[model samples]
Target: MKFKNLLLSWKYPSILLLGIGISNFGAWVYFIALNLIVLDLTNSALAVAGLYIVKPIAALFTNVWAGSVIDRINKRNLMVALDLFRAVFIALLPLTSSIWVIYSVVFVINMAGAMFGTTSRSYITKLIPIEQRKRFNSLRSLIDSGAFLVGPAIAGILFLIGTPILAIYINAVALFLSGIITLFMPNLEKDRSLEQSDSSLSWKIIKQDWAIVLNFSRQYSYIMFMHFLFSCMMVMATAIDSQEAAFAKAVLFLTDTDYGFLVSIAGAGIIVGALVNTMIVSKIQISFLIGLGSLFVSVGYIIYSFSSSFSIAALGFFIIAFSLAFANTGYQTFYQNNIPVEIMGRVGSVFGLLEACLIIITTTIVGVSAQFISIQFVVITGSIIMFALTILLFILSMKPSKSRYYSVKSVEAKDL
Candidate 1:
């Protein structure tokens, strides 16, 4: 009876994680296949690089107004629609020969992806109970870590047996299956009114939503500051990561095979860390997870920045990748527990837009700086900056007075 009751409680969350896992695995397959396809067609590494640019560009275009629509819609149905939308577009990708056409399709797909991200976060927050959030998030992180390794291996197998185009179709199928699975989950807002309808989406309404997010930030200043600092840490990580290939080649003198092995080490670390995190998450405080996890991730980057050999770099990669699961799980729980479901969409989108902008700016700066200066110097500088930010995050997270922010009880959002 106890076992049955536990199974019943986890049924929906388990199903949701399954759908998320499928989608995440498919996304990785699509990413590798798309990069290969572009490289094969254009034979230009820069052309392949453009594929990375499309996602942030898409976010910039979509995120400004996506929240207004996400907050007012049926999140489950919208999630389903977005999955099908991406599936259709992904299915069509193999038929297109022009790189420009592929880019255009990918851009559209990414826009839908941005909206799906916010909608799913809000939906998950609504569906999961407060007390269960941390465990659920830890499980989700474990699934994501599994996907990180499995997705690439599956893509490689598909490439060996078939073409990259075949992998693309497989991803389309995966998205369709994910949509079907999502259909089985109950809708939390089935009877709730859409107070902020899509029909009211406009400059004025978007401005109001911005104001609402700003007002929330003011009321919950510490929370938003933590969010901002976390974003800064991620931005610096991105900037430093942009130089990874160059640093590996120029500084460490690593061959392609060596770099591949290094990545595999990181994958191993992720799986091991996630397994441990899952088993021990209930015993650890959410604040410590966010604080220590983030601080260690930066420490790992600092290690990598100063490494002279492949083994040292691999250790750095392992540490950062391992810490990622904890930091991600902690932040997800914190965001869901604190942000009211009513305004979560807007808050996520607004903050997402800021993060995207920072990514672009920071990446460009890092890239240009590497061209002019040593990649090692640029990477180390960025990592040091990240370390500083995480230290501040760690200090703030340990404050006894601020422990309320990480509590299991949800905080109410102020009215706009």
Candidate 2:
């Protein structure tokens, strides 16, 4: 489906995209402010490092069944509620002077995020026509990339004009706006598998659904393995990011302002890549996109890991961020295509839980090890791990996205 068709569709994916883009901008602003607030409150790099662990830690507990809940509820409604919840949480941040309180709030917010993410994906899979999904995903990536590109600059300006507290409340307001916009999104929760009965919260019902998802995952071993590799790559990327402020300040000798500039550079790179994807690019096989994108991403990280100058580091960031556009778009399309809408939530939660566990462990080890080793060295090591895994993933992605999800019916009809 063309962009024109999407705009012309009554569902109005564009409006949903706009809401997400606004929310994402707010998220980036909140993220920057949160780290700064933590740094000010504790004056310890470790404390800031610990803040990175909050999301995964929350996911560890909540993800076990959040998908079940999401699948049962009206996903669009849930997104609006989650947005409001986060808005309230961010609004409360200024009221607390304690880092612990901040941490607790962040934890709750992350739980909301995890649910919102999973539910949104499942909903999108249903809402958009299959033919249009790739374009939709690309557009979504482009908007998200745009947010990253400008979000830091926005945050920096916010900080200059006022305080971190002010930035937080602004983000809260953005969330509320996001929620209001989401209210316009059409609800598409067709799966009554878990909802038809009153047993959505029942332990037995959830356990039975979990077993089905687990069995399905086991049957699709390659998909699960690939997802695991993606999770590892994600963990590594974030592990490196956890120490990024230190890398900027200590190694590159940058101030907070400079660091924001650096981040914006990465965002700009992604925007360029996304633009290329949405505009000039023709349809490419998902496997090829994933494979080539992974290799490029690895190379980018390698350059970033060993950078000695700000310019070199920015170039590295550019490469990584640019390559991510292709890699993530391919993976997301493949995922949405393959997963059955009914089971998408349950199956996704299992992976979400596992990914969270991996992220926590990866971030925890990196955070603690940095205390003993130089932050640069720790980051370099994580990059090395990421490079290796991406190479492996690139090899795996050469295989076609599962045929069963797409063309099997074509060949099957011929058999008849």
| Model 1: CA > 4 A from native | 192-199, 414-416
Q: Residue 3 error for model 2, in Å?
A: 9.2
Scanning candidate 1 in windows of ten residues, the lowest lDDT window is 191-200
Q: Compared with the true structure, what per-residue lDDT tens digits does model 1 show for residues 1-416? A: 99999999999999999999999999999999999999999999999989888998899999899998888888888898899999999999999899999999999999999999999999999899998999999999999999999999999999999999999999999999999999999977685443435466789999998998999999889888998898898889878887888999999999999998998999999999899999999999999999999999999999999999998999999999999889888888888988889999999999999999999999999999999988999999999999999999999999999999888778875432
> Taking the candidates one at a time, how many backbone clashes does each contain?
0, 0
Q: Over the stretch 271-314, how does candidate 2's per-residue lDDT look in tens digits? A: 99999878743467666566677778878888887998888999
Best by TM-score: 1
TM-score of each: 0.98, 0.88
